[model samples]
Target: MSQNWKFFKESVRHFWQVGSLVQSSRYLVDSLLADVDFAESRLIVEFGAGNGCVTRELLRRMRPDARLFSFELSQVFHEEISSIAARDPRLTAVHGCAMLAAQMFAAQSVDCVVSGLPMGNFGKCAKLGVLSTVHAVLKPGGHFSQFQYSLLDYRLMKRHFPAVRLGYTPLNFPPAFVYNCVSA
Candidate 1:
């Protein structure tokens, strides 16, 4: 919780630009990856992919035909994702709000959406906007994966996804829960 200034500033910059927080621990990385059901996916999108940490991991784990569309608002992080995106045909980093997920992406087009944004950080209106868009973009049987700092959003999550499972990661700084927000 008591993060260094340099790292903290860098994280804020990346997040202000990209919409995600930085995770310094390798254990956090492993936990995020383990919860993802990548084997059945072809179209993958990441919301709030800051600095491309999870995006890079998604690239490494995804199948050959899978395409990744990463949405980050921060220009700094967008440039970072773009720099790497150019090297691979499967990747694309879009500078936009995840709240516009429906219009930005074709309806029911995504097979999986892995979110890194802190949904709890948003206001009720803004939070609902992003959730609605997420629901519209995912195909039936598609999974919307996200991790949270606590189980505070459990009720709303169940309303959004057909199935929602809670798992703990004490290894994460301050400890966190990975919510597999699966759609009906």
Candidate 2:
């Protein structure tokens, strides 16, 4: 089956985890990554990397030496990204939860984190847990970029990052608000 078909099927079956019925648009992906300093980002992590859409884009923009660790909870999506990783030496496809990020990497070691996680679908504690993991793994001035269909997580992000900037991409299926946060 095609990637979109797989994504649609998975989203329908696991809306709360997958978040959207389709993969993000290029416009939305670009907006989500707009603030990343690709040149300076040597180690990057991507959460909720569905079907390697954003993963491919990240690989395209990253420096030849940069590394990306993509985490996906779904077996189907993880398999898809694993295939991409087989072709790209710089990518590591992780079949696990985003909350395990800190365990996988050293504290204050990651340069950036691009998240497509459905924070709005999670309860307050789950949200805080994931945010804390991201914060802990990120360098002092590392970037944390996330996107949500709604603005519900804006204040939550602000609480985690000292600096948070919001951007919009109306071209996506349901549109999305991108939060570019800098870890303190």
Best by the TM-score measure:
2
Instruction: Kindly give the stretch of ten consecutive residues in candidate 1 with the minimal lDDT sum.
Output: 15-24
Cα lDDT for residue 101, candidate 2: 95
Q: In order, what is each prediction's RMSD in angstroms? A: 3.4, 0.8
Question: What lDDT does each candidate get?
Answer: 0.76, 0.94
lDDT tens digits by residue: candidate 1, 1-184? 2323433566675544322344525555566667567788899888987667788888999998899999987676678789879988899889888876788778998898888777767778977887888889998888887777778777888888778877678876657777777787
Could you say which candidate leads in lDDT? 2
**TM-score, one value per model:** 0.86, 0.98
Compared with the true structure, model 2 gives a TM-score of 0.98
**Which ranges of candidate 1 are over 4 A from the true structure?**
1-7, 12-21
Instruction: Tell me the deviation in Å of residue 76 in model 2.
Output: 0.3
Error of 2 at 69 (Å): 0.4
